[model samples]
Structure formats: C-alpha cells, structure tokens
Target: MPYATSAAFAHDWPDTVRLVTVEGAPHTGAWNADAYAYAYAYAKELAAFLAQHT
Candidate 1:
C-alpha cells in the first residue's frame, strides 16, 4: 500500500501501530534477492514486533 494509506491506517491505532517504511521499495521488494538489506531489515523488524506482541 501507499505510504499515505499506510500512515492513515496506522493513525487509527496510534498507540498500537508501528509503521516501518522502506524507501523506493516495491510491494514484494523484501523478497527479492536484490533487496537483501530490505529483507533483513524486514525480518528483524518482524521478529521484534512479534517478540513484543507475544
């Protein structure tokens, strides 16, 4: 989704939502081999989020 839309959605739950945006990243960019950094960051973020929530 677009950044604006994502921000808006996060706005609805300001206290609980954590929005992480990767510049110039496509929807599936994190899965691409060319996007290793983004993928690593995504995985790290996801792990942190899950750890916090669980």
Candidate 2:
C-alpha cells in the first residue's frame, strides 16, 4: 500500500537509485508510461544535482 492519488516515489531498494512507478488499472501495481516519463524527468533532475554537488 502506497500513497496513491498523490504522486510519491517510495520504496526500500538496495541501490543508489530511485524508481518511481505509477499505479495503473485496479488491484495491481502496473506501470503507466506517463508515470515513467515523470520518473525519468525526476531521475534526470536528481542526477544533475548530484553531478553538480559532487
């Protein structure tokens, strides 16, 4: 169960990475293409920031 309705990328992963997956359909955690686009944008932003910071 995640915070749906509001876009939030929450997951406990074992990597220096973040994955955002949007919900699709019912009773499932399917991936929406649009959400992936957003996630890609977010990842780019983060990467840029880290690159600048480090």
Candidate 3:
C-alpha cells in the first residue's frame, strides 16, 4: 500500500476525487506490466468508476 503522503491529491481535495491504488505495484506498473495483468486487473473497476463519475 502507498503511504498517506502519496495521497496528497485526495487529501487536499476529498470531493471530486477518484483514487486508485494498486498494492505493491511499481511506478507506471499499470501501463508497463509485461503481461498487463495489473492494467487488466483494474480495467473494469476503472471503467465503472469513470462511467458513474463522468
């Protein structure tokens, strides 16, 4: 999990925030995963979040 300090954006702006945290994922891991498992893992959730929010 990321440290609380990493959530400055959400902390500063609680409203209108859509935070996504992937445990143990390296920087840019979501977009750069070899098998794209990280990206795929959250694809549906992200899509749903976007659909509801947007």
Candidate number with greatest lDDT: 1
lDDT per residue for candidate 2 within 5-36, as digits (tens), equals 32333234324435444444332333344656
Between which residue pairs do clashes occur in model 2? none
| Model 2 score (lDDT) | 0.51
Alpha carbon RMSD to native, model 3: 4.1
Write one digit per residue (lDDT tens) for candidate 1, span 1-54. Answer: 676787898899887887766667665554563467777877898999999989
- Show the lowest summed lDDT stretch of 10 residues, model 1: 25-34
lDDT of each: 0.75, 0.51, 0.65
Alpha carbon deviation, residue 2, candidate 2 (Å): 22
Clashes of each: 0, 0, 0
Q: Residue by residue across 1-54, what tens digits does model 3's lDDT show?
A: 444654776778877565666666564564554446666757876898889879
**Candidate 3 TM-score, true structure as reference:** 0.47
Candidate 2 at residue 5, lDDT?
33
Q: Deviation in angstroms for 54 in model 2?
A: 1.0
Model 2 CA RMSD to the hidden true structure, in angstroms: 7.3
